[model samples]
Target: MSAAPPEEEEELALPRRPPPCHAVCSSRAFATLYSLVTYALVPAGVVALIEVRYAYLLLFVAQLLLAVGAVEWSWLAFRIRQRLLLAVSLHEDGPPQPQEPTEDAPDSSEHPPPPSSDVNQSEEQTEAAAARRAHALEDQPLRREDPRESYARLMAEAMRAKSFAIAPLADWLFCGQWYLAAFVLASLGAAASVALGYAVESSVFGSANPAAGWRMMVGASVEAAFVSIFCSSLAPSGADSVVLVVYQACVLVASMNAYLKLHVDVIASDSQVDPLFIILAGAIVIIVFRVVTSKVVMQSLLLVLCDVLGLVCIVSPLIAFADLIDQPMGHSFRNQFALFVLVVVATDVGDCLAKELQRHWPQVFQWCRHPLLKSEATTKDVEALAISLACGAIMIVVVRLGSGVSAFNAVEVIVLLCAMALGQWCRLWMAHVRQMAKVTTSAFYLSEGSRAGGVLDRMAVFLVAIIVYYPYIKQKYFSSS
Candidate 1:
């Protein structure tokens, strides 16, 4: 490429300046207090609660701060909603009123004396001037604005934002609901297990000298459920839920063995001495479930399940890497955590690619009719599929070679990523709807020759998204890394 002009290069090379608010904050007491509360007190309290015996006091303070934060967030949301509503209402109201004619003007009945040759010529010039004045006056208001136009603009924006929230709900009805159900069930099951464990351990088992039976029942139930939920959410197909249920039951039985070992005061060091046999048995059951389910059920659920699993796969690695950076080695805790994230991402990508590949024929037809659809397809689809397959194959090889690898964290990350994607999708739909409405209103107003006003309003959105969110994302995700 040719080198850019000096002036253009100079413009591009401009340095970033701190935001006005950032500078103002350094000068203001209230802003400083706000910073202290959010950045200092809140985090300190949370950490103190986690690592200290006097944590209850900090926890109480944290809760109070949280209450204040919630109120502030709610208020901000309310204000935004209100402004949006008002803007919509105002658009529907139309433009400003036109100015009326003045009462203090010369009457048509007034007549001057009969003009000679020179007087007639002067009168003709005067009449032409008056005509031009009237024309200029007529165009002035059109150049300014009609208040009604503003109302129409707001109406369009309101409609768009409204539709964005609507479309996702409709889309979710067909595809997202089952995944939603699974997520809810897993979370609920976890909550129930925690509650039950706490209740039984505190009340039935007694902290001073708990009954082995009750403690085993509570601990086993909680741990098993955790494993089950984690496994099912990660699985591409099979009786995922059923597998989890079985795992929980088997673990319950194994808890008796654990209690016996504890009673004997056994301190066996090898992996074989651990109660991991129950976990191994659960995996075997899942493998069996996968085989049986393949033969019995239609594989539609597998596709959706895989997609959900894959999404978690992609995000998990990043989180694990983040964790690994924080964690020290020697007692290197679950290095596979990051790898699992990769696997989840890979699986999700694979699932998506497989589906996309399957739809290639249909996509071809779609592209024939909708050129834009073709343009939107990117390498991401292909890359994700390849990664997923690679992760799965690698896991298989690792298993065969007897190398250690954990896919759980990867699975969790992918799932959470899917949830995040869903949230973003919803937001995107809403934004698109709002833009369309705004553009339509702008177009209608522009038809009457309102160029500067229309462009200003249209450009504001692009500026905000680019100037705000893009930088925020870069800072959050890429800056440190």
Candidate 2:
């Protein structure tokens, strides 16, 4: 066989170097550095929150940005690794060989065997020959399916299974099996945050309504649900689950000490039964029902009902305990509650809209075939930015006009907008890293197993623990009589 032309060989040559960003980001050193920076910011943020009480809302917003950014970054990393592995595999395997022509092909060049002796044979001999041929065919090995074809088929099936439309609450409830643990952790984290907030308010102002604690706990659960839904939308496959769960668990543990300090009295002096015990029992029953029931619809319905009840719990106390906080700067519980609900709904709607646009907008644009908008990446970027801006505007309006909350003013809106921008920038940086890693010369290099990222992650947990215990330490031996 003749060798391929030089031009063909050149065209087939792999690039000697990958994109710089990908090379850097994919390195173990870079991963460690990034982890260090992110984890360090947690303590710094906590310190800022302690020093500037009024910035609590801003801190909360920043925390959300950090969390979303981390999960997104982790997901991007997973994608980059998968792509790199696939590329390497394909490069090593090279192009596939053409298969031999099958009997069914009309254009097959091979001719059938002549039937001279078979025609002269008797009926019994012909029948024996046919059985022998059938046996031979059955003994032959089956041809393997082409890997590329199988991959394409799977991709098609996955795309078809994906619904660009936002799932109904019932559907969302039962969708991802891995999400259950994430949701539980997020809910616990939110509850702990509320507990900490109650502790701070009680310590500073001298008293707090127990009812407020209950309301805050429920509100936190709703917040968790909103966050979980948002993260799920971003990464449908299971990449972000680990980051989400770890971060939320850290938050939960960090607030534990403070939570213990301003804790709601679970025991009722008038009754032998503890309300806490009853609540725990009820929770266990719900979980058991969810696990034991074979009916998916029933399970989903039960979960949805639980979420609704949590929301109601948050809102019910607003009207009755709105005046519980007498601080001039303190937000109206009613307004904050309303804003939380608005955020949840707005994010859900926005995610659905984004998903639909992502799935269909390309087809719309392709049909038009505008030269300026030919790049799919550009179109996606524009769509994402537009959605983000629209969501931000809606949030600003909600904050500006919503009644009951005095704390979220124009300044808070501006802060939130800035935070959103920062989060987007972080995402862009992560994307750049991923792209660089994908095209780097070091693509073939294996990364050394480093415990740095893990260590940093544990550090975050430790920091939260200290925060939770700080209040306890102060109360235990340092109390002034």
Q: TM per model?
A: 0.26, 0.32
Best by lDDT: 2
RMSD of 1: 21.4
Runs of candidate 1 exceeding 4 Å displacement = 1-19, 22-79, 82-84, 87-148, 152-481
Q: Write model 2 residue lDDT over 39-120, tens digit each, in one string.
A: 4554445434433443223323333543454344333344344444444555678644534423332222333333577765
How does each model score on lDDT?
0.38, 0.40
| Sequence-dependent TM-score of model 1 | 0.26
Score residue 46 of candidate 1 by CA lDDT: 41
- Per-residue alpha-carbon lDDT of candidate 1 for residues 199-294, written as tens digits (9 for 90 to 100): 655543444454644644555455555545543442222343454355335434443343323332222324223334554554555555555656
Task: State the TM-score for model 2.
Answer: 0.32
For TM-score, the strongest prediction is 2
